[model samples]
Target: MKVVEQIKAPILDEMETFEQKFSNSMSSKVALLNRITHYIVNRKGKQMRPMFVFLVAKMLSDNEKANERTFRGASVIELIHTATLVHDDVVDDSNMRRGFFSVNALWKNKIAVLVGDYLLSKGLLLSIDNEDFDLLKIISVAVREMSEGELLQIEKARKLDISEAVYYDIIRQKTATLIAACCSLGAASVQPNSVHVEKMRKFGELIGMAFQIKDDLFDYGETAIGKPTGIDIKEQKMTLPLIYALNTATDKDKDWMINSVKNHNKNKLRVKQVIQKVKDLGGLEYAEKKMLTFKMEAIDILQQYPNSDYKSALELMVNYVIDRKK
Candidate 1:
């Protein structure tokens, strides 16, 4: 079966219910707000964060039934994630998202910011209304970490001095934290067993790390995956591949790279040169090795859980994280 089918087959019903809950959670009385929310909901991507919540919940729950609390937990995570994406589009000045015009693009920056704020508040209120404090705590930490990661990346981009260690730290906070929260929230919604929650959290973190690395690798590839190749370089974002290549390059080569990223990144020739340098220095291979290592670690964590269809689906998701082209 295709990876997506394998992951979704076991949780089809839960996903349908989660979708309803998600839409309901975002409902607004104001017409413009409602329209924007509807547009955002309609253009939603794979819903992978909520998928993690359901998959981990089922794997950890005794009866494997996703209760109302599970659906609420998933809805809360999705709201927070959606809010972040809206704000991210604004901050990046991006006009498109997920193959559609971004909220900021269609509604302008002011409305987009308000929409993001509305989504964030709705998520917080969902947790409070449901009295799901544990889930709120998990989601709150993920939000904080994601914010810190974005700021850190922006700070590092100005200097283009990101170390391999700093690169990992950035991705962990920016990307992995949310995924980790999804797994922990899933386990919490089911049983609140610390052991189970921590295990799934770690498993999700590993895969999340792998997922970001795979995204970084895409920046160096010849094919376009949503965004153009070397967009990271153009933005002066020091991703894993560039970090690796910069660390191994000679003084003269490093100077050229630094200059290219800092000044000439907009030039297609310079960007291509940067891409070629990363390839020539084995940056891509190094990143792939690290990504696979995390993928294996996530799989090992799954092995500790009892065998179930949910477990099998989670395993497939780990494979998909690295294998997905976009």
Candidate 2:
């Protein structure tokens, strides 16, 4: 079975209910807002964030009952995630997302900005209305971390000076924090002990770290995964592979690599050369090893829980994190 299919199988009924609740959360009185939101709902991605929320909640809950708080938790996290994506498209100046025109592309920057804000408010209000303050705290921290990560990356990108440690920090905040929040929210939704919530957060963080590393590795390959190869290089984003290659390269080769990224990034041949050099220098191997380390660590955490379909699905999701092509 597909990764999503495997992960959602155990939670199929709850997922349907979650979908309805999610749509209701996105509704608005304003016609234009409603139309845009309807479009967003129609063109939604895999809903992986909410799935994580539900799966972890089920896995950890003593009674295994997906209560109203659980549904609200999923809805809140999904709203926050959607808001981030809408805002990200504007920030990236991208015209498309998930194979469709981005909100910014269709509605212009101002409207897109407002729509993102609206979604964010909806998420906050959901938590407040449902008194899901624990979930609110978790997601709010993720939001703050995400903003910091983006700004830090932008600052480093201008000078091309991201170290390996900084690279990890950036990815943790930019990508992993929200995923961690999803898992933590899942545990919290079930009213688990603080220990369980913390453990799930750590597991999610490890998987998320592996996931980002896998995505960074893709930049050096020729695989067609929506974006073109060397796009990260062309954009001057210092991923793990390139960072590793640069650290181990000879001074002359290092200067060449740095200069190419700084000046010749727009040149297709130069980008390909950088990609090739990264591979030749064992960058991909290093990244793969690190990715697997995190993946294993995440799996080890799951071993503490009793065996169940939900636990098995969570394990599948960890494997899927490193295995996904895109």
lDDT of every predicted structure (CA atoms): 0.90, 0.91
Pairs that clash in candidate 2: none
Please give the range of 10 consecutive residues that has the lowest summed lDDT in model 2.
Answer: 219-228
Cα displacement (angstroms), candidate 1, residue 89, comes to 1.3
Task: In angstroms, give how far residue 304 of model 2 lies from its true place.
Answer: 0.6
Q: Poorest 10 consecutive residues of model 1 by lDDT?
A: 220-229
Query: How many residue pairs clash in model 1?
Result: 0
Give the C-alpha lDDT of model 1. Answer: 0.90
lDDT string, candidate 2, 65-159, tens digits: 69898899899988988999999999889999999999999999999999999999999999998778888999999999999999999999998
